[model samples]
Target: MPSETQLAYFLQQLLNAAPLSALYAMLAFGYSLSFALTKRADFTPGALFAFAGQVFVYFTAFGYDRLWLVYPAALALGVAASLAYTMLASTLTGSKVIRPLSQMSPNSVITASLAIMIVLMELVRIAANTRDLWLSPFLNQRITFWDHPGFPVVMTQIQIMNALAMAAIVFAAAYILQRSRQGRNWRAVSDDPFAAALLGIDPGRVIVFAGLTTAAFSAISGIMATAYYGSMDFGAGLMFGLKVVMIAAIGDQSSPARSAAGAALFGLAETFWGAYMPYVWRDLAMFSTLVVLAVVMRQERRV
Candidate 1:
């Protein structure tokens, strides 16, 4: 049996890790969505994540002080921007120009994705004046619970909403992939585009659909992240995108559910490390584990 102090510490870590885990899960899902169709991790989502948050901030700033009206406007703009980018990236990558190259070499598709990410990030920087943009602080209020001697667990309203949103997104993605006709089409294309097309499914259309869905996931993630942090920085999206890629790689890029599970585990590890270890070593420790996982996965695939 654990002592009271140990139990309190564990509970505190759980509360702190919940929101971060949800964010990683959603981000990993976005990666999985694109991978399902292209068999390549889509770096486009990193830009979309940053773009959505920046656009949201821009629109809210444009609205001046009328938050009720501005918030919706901001959300719409962010969603639109994310969708637009996803479409463009998906179409280009799936186009005849890039599709042939993708078949010959995975590097080609990854390069295109990286290029798109850079372009979008530059665009965002230009629009946001290369600075950290702020959002209204309404969601930053914390709700304290589970009071203990020298250990109190607290969660922000935004964090709660973020957690709920992640759950819904994950559920919806699983449902679509598992039960829906469109999802069946996506899987068919994923398995073999030529074969799927022979069966009358448009591979292009399925790819586009997958890209759009992934964009939607990234848009929601960006919005929630901005709301939770109360600010958006230029590099946040890039870092986030990279982290999700790591999580997906560690979990298995081919399986979104597995990737999400890996993300949750990573989140838990991160929380515990932050609480118990020095802050500087936290990322090193997490990333070292990721490297080990990647190697193990590679060896497993070989077997």
Candidate 2:
């Protein structure tokens, strides 16, 4: 049996992990949506994640500076801009670049996605002049669940809201994917594009549709993260994207539920590491574990 203090600490860490894990799960599910269909790990969604948040910050700043916008108005404007840009970019990329290149070679799609990621990063860097663009945090009131003297298990309102929102989004998406005609078309294309076409399903249209939903998920996570953390670095997208890719790959990428579950587990493990291990070693530890998992999974596949 653990002591009271140790139990309190563990509970506190678990509560702290919830929001982060939800964010990871949301991003991974978005990546998996299109990955399942195309089998191409188009990394632009990573850049899209950063891009959405940065765009939100930029537009909100504009509203504040020129329009004398209030908090609500600024937030609405920022969200609209972020979603619009993300949707446009995602749809165009899927229809024009990724879909065509994917047909040629998966490697080509990967290279193109990397190039797109670099371009997005550069655009964000140039827009911000390589400076930190910050947002004013809101809905950050801490809610204490167990006030264990010196070790209170606390969570913020925004964190709870974020977790609930992501959970709702994932469940809703899963439901739609499993029950809707569009879902059937998506799965058909994912299984075999030629077969899907023979069945009168337009694979290209399904890819574009998946891309739009991916954009929606990316914008949502990006906005929530920016709002919670007060800002996100534009350059963080690559690492964020790579980490999510690895996490989703570790899961059953064919199913959103499994991808989310894997991502949540990864998130919990990562948060625990940060709590128990040296902060500097957290990323190294997580990535190393992922690499080991990848090797093990590959070997198992071969065997």
Using TM-score as the measure, the top candidate is 2
Could you give the C-alpha RMSD of every candidate to the true structure, in order shown?
3.2, 1.7
Which pairs clash in model 1? none
Error of 2 at 289 (Å): 0.9
Query: 33-147 in candidate 1: lDDT tens per residue?
Result: 6786777665667767776776667666655454555675765665565456545554564564346767788777767767766776777788767877687676667788767
True-structure RMSD for candidate 2: 1.7
Taking all chains together, the TM-score of candidate 1 against the true structure is: 0.86
TM-score of each: 0.86, 0.95
By summed lDDT, the worst window of 10 consecutive residues in model 2 runs over 293-302
- lDDT tens string, model 2, 140-254? 8999999888677888999899888888888888888899999889889989999989989998889788888888898889988888888878777888888878888888666
